[model samples]
Target: MSRIGRLWNSLANPDRIPKLFAIVLGAVILIGFLIPLDLNVDQLYPRPVPQEQVEENISTAPYARGGEVLESPGITRAQYPENSKSLGWINSYMSPLAIWVASTSPYFGTSIYSSPGGLIDEILYYTRGFDTILESTILMMAFVIASWLGVNFTMNRKKREAEAAADKSKDYYDPTLNKNKTYYYNNQNSNIKEEQD
Candidate 1:
């Protein structure tokens, strides 16, 4: 057969199914990592906390001495600068989640109340829990398949070695025998009988 045909046959072998599956899974993970995440801030946080309210609260706080508050404006998307393209893209997409988490977290003292640990806990336990479970299950199955294949290969090798050893022992020469032990014994018995007669 041709080289391509042989390669195809090898790849299609049932014994290699686990390896093929692992390769596919690895490719999927690679693709997922390469794809950029797109998140809309407006959709994630429909009602953001007003900047005026935050500033007012900070200004009137006991920490503010002589009722003086910092008047510097916060950084906007247009004003933000980044040197790396990949990092910039990641920051733009992930900033919404960060904003949502910070705004909803009880630690930040926002108007919206969230459970302890906030949005992060909710996403991990509720939204993304199934994906985590499936990933772990697939990993475990791959490990099991690899271990089973290794064990079977070792067992088969040992069995072949034992068979070879047995064959070698059977084929060895015997010092007490001539060409064949049975024939040598038969001929000797016949000669003894003839002499007795």
Candidate 2:
């Protein structure tokens, strides 16, 4: 069999069961994205507006209560939000979206009240906490990585200095190894010349 085919067979064996676990984990993440999970916001938190206020606004019939927009007789110029142009439609659409997100999903849902306006507040409030935590974690991780790099650099520098000290010279030779010396006997040169004659 081909090498690649053998590898495939090996991976398919029961011994490589960890691949199944990895597949399961990937599936869970995909499902989480498709079907949102519950957030841990109790009803007590962030304070629900008083029911009396709601009832009063309803009785008055002119003022809008947060999301609720009211239509009036002979008022053609009924100023409504661009998305919620009229009270009736605005109340109809936004209410359900907010309730669904807030009550069902991990997102804290739409903030009905905001400084400047409600929609801007909703955008900021729901996402602010996560953004803050993410930023903070990234900053902290960067600091840690930088510190680790500095320590490693210092250690490597010290090691090089120690090595340089040990290797003071590379052409190292023991003095005892050069004990033998050469001698020249030029005095015997005249005797060699007389024999040759």
What is the lDDT of every predicted structure here?
0.47, 0.44
Q: For candidate 2, which ten residues in a row score worst on lDDT?
A: 175-184
What is candidate 1's lDDT per residue for 1-197, written digit by digit as tens?
68877678667556688988899999999999888998776553133355643566542121111211123212122212352122112211213453476445433433233222323322344445577789899999999998897776654656654555567557654423223665877789779656643
- List TM-scores for all candidates, in order: 0.27, 0.22
lDDT of 2 at 68: 34
The best candidate in terms of lDDT: 1
> Which stretch of 10 consecutive residues in model 1 shows the poorest summed lDDT?
60-69
| Tens digits of lDDT, candidate 2, 44-145 | 113335555345533212222244333331112222235324322232123445445534533232233212233323323332436666878999999999
